[model samples]
Target: MKKDIQIPEVSNVYVSVVNEYNDIYKTHDWNAYIINDKDVALEMVLIVTRGFSEIKSTSTMRHKLDMLPAKSYAKIEFMQEDVLALNNEFKVTFFEANKMFEKTYLFRKNTINKKALQTIPLMEVRGVLVK
Candidate 1:
């Protein structure tokens, strides 16, 4: 008779946003809890929002953290702005340790009372088994 093996659940995941120019604005570790899982696969998403302005030039560009993975493939998209804009949006997708994950956002489309930028800093990571 063969025995059935159970895979442990993946949890305790988070995300953060880093500004390469300003270290002070960088977050070491932000809270982005996992809310969904399926068939030994875990999925998560996060967002970071902010605002900025520039003088001297009418055209402005914002850099966003798109896709970043330690050992997997990823895809990222910015739906709302072109190369020139004071504000922007971001969307990211990636696979970690063989599992899939994704994130998305839209920025600079609402009143000043709302957030201007969004980011996803972390993805749940796992180890692959070798035969």
Candidate 2:
């Protein structure tokens, strides 16, 4: 009976981290974004994120969106410099084609740095992407 469960595989969706300039704060900040590259829209999008290490962890954060259109992206949250040393994880769940799908993206500890950045999909800026 348990084998009957089927969770659709999530594709063309990604979570990325970007170091961007904050005009109000006059500082460079690390921000998280969710990118949907598919031709179809995603509904009931939800994201839960957290940072953790072997002995330390940050609070869990939950974010929601009514819909995420195709070929678009949305900012999830900002990360302080201190959390860069911990493993950051983003769990994304959404409904597409009348089915529910989920995927988890991770930025390993110390990996979200300028050296690891590349042109993020569907966005003009360069950033570290989890695919």
Candidate 3:
């Protein structure tokens, strides 16, 4: 069995999230864009956690990129209701650098009274892991 690992931080990679709503069409849109701003190519594994109350859910994505071509973005989109959890977590690993990053956000605390459509940069991380 492999032991669970904890990694150190590697900066420059970013996760940008935007929320969109359509009142007339009754649609909810949540977009997550992972940006790699480094000069080297990256292999990444991403995980996101969402839920409310006792129930929880997770979504994962993995990709091998050609350096993200410098300042380009790869995006994933999901419905807003899917992330109803007050506390949301994002984990990303850069295979090329052998670094891992984790971040958690409290939706109710941060966006309770904010506009429905908003963009936030998840810069500060909760934990980091390295090989």
Which of 1 and 2 is ahead in TM-score? 2
Score every model by TM-score.
Answer: 0.24, 0.98, 0.51
- How do the residues 1-131 of candidate 2 rate in per-residue lDDT, one tens digit apiece? 88998998888999999999999999999999999999999999999999999999999999999999999999999999999999999999999988999999999999999999899988999999999
RMSD after CA superposition, every candidate: 14.2, 0.7, 7.2
lDDT of each: 0.30, 0.96, 0.47
Clashes of 2: 0
Backbone Cα, N, C clashes tallied per candidate: 5, 0, 7
lDDT tens digits, residue span 9-122, model 1? 333222222212225656322221222222233323333333334532222323333333332323222222222233333333334455554454333322211132343333
Candidates in descending lDDT order = 2, 3, 1
State in Å the error of residue 126, model 2. Answer: 0.5
Residue pairs that clash (backbone atoms under 3 angstroms), model 3: 6-129, 7-128, 7-129, 7-130, 8-129, 8-130, 51-85
lDDT of 3 by residue, 39-128 (tens): 765655444544444455455434343444445556644536445434344455556555554444334423322244333333232211
Candidate no. 2 TM-score: 0.98
Q: Residue 111: error of model 1 in Å? A: 6.5
